[model samples]
Target: MPESVSAVLGPRYRAVAVPVDGGDLHVGVWEPEDAAATGAATPTAVLTHGITASHVSWAALARALPGVRLVAPDLRGRGRSRDLPAPYGMPRHADDVAAALDHLGVRDAVAVGHSMGAFVALVLADRHPHLVRSLHLVDGGMPLLPPPGVAPQDVAAAVLGPAADRLRMTFPSRTAYREFWSDHPALGPYRDEVVTAYVDYDLVGEEPELSPATRPAALEEDIRDLVDGASVQASLQGVPARPVTWYVAPRGLMDEVPPLYPDAARERWTRELPTLRLVAVDDVNHYTVVLGAHGVRQLLPHLEADLR
Candidate 1:
C-alpha cells in the first residue's frame, strides 16, 4: 500500500459513536483527503458491511477509493455499533442506516452493500427510494430462499453459521479470538494489508474480548429477523426500479454442502428481477470475491462510472 493510502486508512482507524434516533451506535467514516481540510462535501459512499464483520471489512475498498468519502456503519449489532435492544431484522438495519444518513445530512448518494448488507440495502431502497441516488451490491445478490422441504435448522446453520458460532462462543481470550478469525472462511482470501487493518480497527479495550463490535445475540436476532418470518427474496420487492445490481462470486456457499445457491435459483432471481444488472466474476469464492484486488477492481465501475 502507498503512503497516501496508509495515512488515510490510519495507523489505526478510529471508531466514532453517532447518535441516532433509536440509540447511539459505532461507525467508521473515511473522508477523502481533498475534502478533509477544505470541509468541501464530496460525494459520500456509504457501505453496509456483511453480517459478521464490522467497518474494517470495507477498509481495503475505502483505502482503494480515497477520492470518494466512505461511511461504513456497524449494522445495529455488528461491528462497533450497538447490539439489539428488542430484536433485529432487515427493516431495523435499514432504519439504522437511514438515521446515519440523516445525521450526516446526506440527501442522495450511492448506497453499497455486501452479502447480508446487500439485503439491507435492498430494503432501504425499497422503503426509502427517494433517499438513494443509486445502489450497488458487491458479492451480494437478491437472497432467494432455499427451496421447500429444507429444514429450518439446516438453513440456519448454513446461512447463519458464523452468527450461530458467535452467539454460542466465549473466547478464552482476545488472542484466541484472533486465532479463530485468522482462518475464517470469508476473510481468508483478503490481502494481508486488508486483513491486518481489518483486525486492528476492531480492538475495543483491555477486557481482551473480541467481537464484531456488536454483540453475538444481536447478530442472531438480525439473521432471524431477516430470514425467519418472511422470504428473504421478498425484500427485493421493496427496492423496485432502484437500479439493482450484483457482483456475484461464481462459486457460492453451496460448495460446502447441501448447495445453498444453485445456478437455477440464480437464474430465477435474474429472471424475476428483470432490471437487476449482474456482473459475474470468475474463480472466486464467497469470501475472496469481496476482499482482494479483484474485488476492489470490480467495485469501482459500479460506484464511480455506472452511477453517472
Candidate 2:
C-alpha cells in the first residue's frame, strides 16, 4: 500500500487476505472508533466498488461513518486481487463478499455498493440474504437501459469508454497515472489526498511500464452480467420487497448531462420497484456520487436510518 493511503486510512485500518475459491481476496477493514472505545459490537457495512475500482474507492465513506465498521474488498481481477483467476461475474463477486464477511464473523450488514458494486450488492442480498440486512445502492443496481441500436453485449464498451479503455494502456510512472486521472472531468475537480491515494494504489509493476490493476476481462464479464444476465434479472425481481435505497447522480461519468440513471429510467424503475427509494444527489457525477462529499452527505441519513 502507498504511504498516502496509509495516512488517509489512519491507524485503525488493516488489510486482510481472505481465502476464496481461486485465490485470496484483499479486504480492507476499518475498525470503528466509538465501538473500540466502549467495547460495543461495531456496526459493519460491506462496501463494493465499481467495475474498474478497488477497495480504496470507499475511503471517504469509511471516514464519514466513524462508528460503522467498513469492510471493502478488491473483487477478483481488480486491485490487489487482480491475479485471482477468471469465471468472474456478479454471482462470483457476491460470493467473494460473503466469504469476506464470514471470515470476519459479520452478518446482517448494510450492503452499500457504488457503480458495479451496486449490482454485486443486489446479488449478495438475493443469494445470501442472511449476510445482508439492507441495501444502499449508489448510481447503479437498477437495470441500465442501453441506448437504442446498441446490443446488450456491446453496452460495456459503449457506456464505459475511457474507464474500460485504460486497462490496456500502460503508464511510465505512478506520477504519469496521477496526471492521467487529473484530467478526468468527474474526478479532476475533487482531486485530493483520498483521490490521489486511490490513483496511486491503482498502479502495479515497475516504473516505465506500470499498468492499472483492473483486468479488462473482469470488466467485460461483469458489465455483460449487469446488462442482461439471468442472475441480475432475477435479483431485480426481489428489489421491491427488499429494503433498498438508491441514490442517483445528476451528472454522467465525465461530468456531462444525462446521468447514468436519468429521470425516465428512475421513473420506470420506481414504478416497477415501488418500494425502492430513489434519491437524486445534486452536483456529483457517476464517480463523485460515491467519491465526493455531496454523495456522502446524501448517504448519511439513509445509513443512520437503516443502521439505527
Candidate 3:
C-alpha cells in the first residue's frame, strides 16, 4: 500500500480479514503509536464509514483520537470487500460490523458512524446491544423525512444527485478520478494528501478504464434504507434515552447554505428525538464532517467525552 493517510499522525495500523457468512470482511485496526511502542491495550472505537466510502476515510479520526484504538471495516461492496455477495442493506451492514467486533475479541466498543454509517451504527447497537456501549452519529442516523408525495427512489435521487450518479460512470485513470473530485464543491476545500489517499483508493482497474470500487446496486439498497427502511426506523425508536451526540456540518454536499438538516427540520427532529444531542460545527459540509481538520477537531472531544 502507498503511504497511509494517517502515517504522519503517529498511529500504527494493520489490516485483518475476519470471516463472515458471505465472505471475509476486511478490518483495519489502528493504535496510538505511543501505545503500540509501549505495548499496552487501549479502549477501542468501532468506526463505520459513509456510503461508497472505505475504511481509509477514518484516517482523520484515527489521528485525532490516537489514545483510543480504532477499528474500521470496509463495508461489503465498497472496498477490499467489494466482491462480497450482496443482499446489502443497513441491517446486513450492522451484522457484518458486529461480526467484526466479535472476531477481533472486542467485547464492547463505542460505535462511531458518519452519514449512512450512522444508520448502520444505530442498527448495530440495537441488534447487538451488549457489544456497543455508546453511539456517536456524525451528520446522520436520524430518519430524514422525504418531501410529501415523493417516492423513496425519487427522494434518493434528489438527495444523492451526483454522489449517486457517478457510480455508473468510469474514469480513465486514478489521477483523472482525483481531478474529478477536485472540482467537487464539498471536496475542493480539502485538497490535501489525506483526500488524495481516499479518492485514489476509491478507484479500481486498468489505466484505460477504471471505476470506483463501490457497486451501484449495493449503494442503491443502502440509500433506500436511509430514506425508508424498517431496521433503521426500529433502531431509532428502540434505542434508549442515552446521551447520543450527532455532530452536523452546517453545509450540504455541494457546500450549500442550508445543511442536510435545515433549521426547521432540525428543530422538529430535535423535539421528536429528545434524547439526541445535536451540535452544528461551522464551515463544514456533509463530506467534510468526518474528513476535514476542523470537523475532526470538533469530533475528538465528543469521542473521548466519557472513556470507560
Candidate 4:
C-alpha cells in the first residue's frame, strides 16, 4: 500500500467480499478505533462511489471520520467488483448496497454518494428506506439535462467526455496511466499520493495493456438509466419527502464551466423538491467535490451533523 493509503486507512481498514445475487461485492470497511472498546453502537455510513470509480474514492472521507464506521462498496462493474455479473442499473446497484449493509449488520446509515453513485443512493433510500437514515448526495442525484440534439445513448459520452473515452483506450504501463490522469484538467491539478493510489487501483490488466477497471457495458447501462430511466425520475420525485442534502460543485467533470447541474437546473429541482437543501461548494469540480481536500472540508460539517 502507498504511504497515503496507509495513513488514510490506518489500522482498522479491511476488505471483505459481501455476497450478492451473482457474485460477491468488494467492500472496504474502516472501523473506528473505539469500535472494540464499545459502549453505544458506532455510527455507520454507507458510501457509494461514482459511475467509473470504486471504494478507494472514499479514502479521504474515511480518514477524517475516525469515530464513524465507513462502509464503501465498489458498485458492480467497477473496481474489484468489475467481474461481478450485472443486469446493471440503479436498482441493481441500490440492492447490492442493501445486501452489503445486511451482511455487515448495519442499519440506519448516513448514505453518501458521488456522481452516478448519487443516483444509486437515491434509489437505495427509496427502495430501502429502513437502511438509510439520511442522504448526502455529493455533486449528483438530480436528473441531468442532456445537451440539445444528443441522443439519450450519447449523453454519457457528451457529459463524461475523456472519462468515458478513456475506457476504450489501453495503457502500456501504470506510469502511462498515471500520466494520463496527471494531464486531466480536473484531477491533474489536485494529484497527490491519495489520488495517485486511486489512479493505480483503477488499472487491472497486464502492464503492457492495462485498461481502466470500469466495464464499458456497465457504464453504458448505468449511464442510460441515469440519463432517462423511469426509476431515477421516480426517485427524484420522492426526494422532497426524504431527508436529503445535495452538495453542488460549480465546475464540471473536466473543470469546465456550466456544471453538470447548472443554476437553472438547480432552480428547477429546487422548485420541484422544495425541501431539498443545496449547498454551492465553489472552487471544486465534479471530481474534486469529494476527492480533494477543499471539498472534504466543506463536506465534513454537514456529514458530522447528520451523523449526530
Off by over 4 Å in 3: 4-11, 34-41, 147-153
- Model 1 residue runs over 4 Å out of place are 1-8, 11-15, 36-41, 147-149, 152-154, 189-191, 200-212, 225-234, 252-260
Model 3: weakest 10-residue lDDT segment is 2-11
User: What's the lDDT for all of these models?
Assistant: 0.65, 0.88, 0.82, 0.88
| Candidate 2: regions farther than 4 A off | 37-40
Candidate number achieving the greatest TM-score relative to the actual structure = 2
lDDT of 3 by residue, 215-303 (tens): 99888878878777899988987556455787788998788876777787688878978888888888888888788888888888878
Candidate 3 accuracy as lDDT: 0.82
Which ten contiguous residues of candidate 1 have the minimum total lDDT?
Answer: 252-261
Pull out the clashing pairs in model 2.
none
Question: Which lDDT tens digits does candidate 4 get at residues 12-93?
Answer: 7998899998999999999887998653578999999998898888888877888999999999999889998979999999
Error of 2 at 34 (Å): 3.0
Clashing pairs in 4: none
Given candidate 1, what's the lDDT at residue 206?
44
- Point out the worst 10-residue segment of candidate 2 by lDDT: 34-43
Q: Which ten residues in a row have the lowest lDDT in candidate 4?
A: 1-10
Superposed Cα deviation of residue 301, candidate 4 (Å):
1.0
Order the candidate numbers by TM-score, best to worst. Answer: 2, 4, 3, 1
Report the Cα lDDT for residue 307, model 1: 35
TM-score of candidate 3 relative to the true fold: 0.94
Candidate 1 TM-score, C-alpha based = 0.83
Rate residue 247 of model 1 by lDDT. Answer: 74
